[model samples]
Target: MTYAITQTCCADATCVAVCPVNCIHPTPEERDFGSTEMLHIDPKTCIDCGACADACPVDAIFPVESLSAAQREYGPLNAAYYEGREAGSVTSGPNFHAWGEPVFERVLPSGFAPVRVAVVGTGPAGMYAVEDLLLHTGAEVTLIDRLPVAGGLIRYGVAPDHPSTKKVQDVFARFHAHPRVRMHLGLDVGKDVTHRELAAHHDAVVYAVGAGADRRLSVPGEDLPGSLSARTF
Candidate 1:
């Protein structure tokens, strides 16, 4: 009844943070996380609690019993990640502690003061930054985005066919209305609020604004008017 991570895995590591048994592999803390194509579940250590599946943003995790024919291979692929490693080792994953145990102190010192932060994007990068600041520190976040809505890349960059990937917006949206959060949408930074103004108010400012550029087709008419990139179209 163990769960497995399939090809659709986005490697956002959301599941890794919630797995009660820490069965997910190549966690963000691991060096291989950057190069790993996708995350896997260690079937041997999985308690079949279905926590990873529930936490998966892209719906990449599924129960072994429910895997389709094409996805069934993932069951073995997941188990192979832990084949040469022991569960309790550092490289093997975060299984050294007991299930649901706190591996590290996530709370800040009681004497720490709450600092205001201005994040200049409402996309995944901006929201993820906000999430960490709010959860791990006593920082007050001021969420700012040029668009009327939050969710930068998650809202615009992801294709319509990949609805599962969009589910992550729900995760990021949770912090938009937090007690310590102040949202400012439909406001351009340079035009409406200057960098100095943000710096003057907040102790820190994070610019998670992602870059978007059109790919060159190298065609003669590619640069002509009325032509737009797929991202823009």
Candidate 2:
């Protein structure tokens, strides 16, 4: 029997450090680690130790025997990642600070107090809002996103080849690295956490969620197979 990591897995790779046999594929250091939607466990090498399940921060790992009917699909997804790979084939590199460490010794403004704030998204607008709030107001910001990974639409919607536009992700990354920022990835505000809960935790809530679906144009044959919306491809 083997355990599998599911959709809820954040790809943080905390479980990879604990597994005795290293059955988890795309470990944080792998090239695919940054791009993979979720982590996968190798069934052939798994010893059913359950260490991965124990280490998962989001409760995404589950043993084969314990998996609910709804989670059965993850079993194949996990195993498929390693179907053709040789044992111990995966590897990762050392953490190189390509962008030099941020200057931390600089003095901050006096009379600036930290304000508890909640930001509802992690996209360009949300990140920029948080960055401005922190730099200007010293607000303690909590950024929330529904996807397990942050960077919002940049992660899911942006095409990989758009490197120039993708550079904006670095801005979000800086916001995420700020000491005043707390990220709640994989959480849906109205579903996983309520507005009341946020109200209780924060002095104020700022909804920086970007515009939703693009306005639709109504015309004949709009539903044809070749049709695609500006908001979605």
- Best by lDDT, which number? 1
Q: Per-residue CA lDDT of candidate 1, range 1-233, in tens? A: 78899988889998988876667879887899969778988887777888788878778999998999988898898888888897753333545445445566666677988889999999888888998888888899999998898888888888888788888898888899999999999998988989999899999999988864667889889878999887786
Clashes of 1: 1
How well does candidate 1 score on lDDT at residue 223?
Answer: 79
* TM-scores for the candidates: 0.83, 0.47
Where does candidate 2 stray beyond 4 Å? 1-113
lDDT (Cα, 0-100) at 2 in candidate 1:
84
Off by over 4 Å in 1: 83-113, 212-219, 224-227
Q: Look at candidate 1 and tell me the lDDT of residue 75.
A: 87
Best candidate, TM-score: 1
- The 10 consecutive residues of candidate 2 with the worst lDDT sum are 91-100
In model 1, which range of ten residues has the least summed lDDT? Answer: 88-97
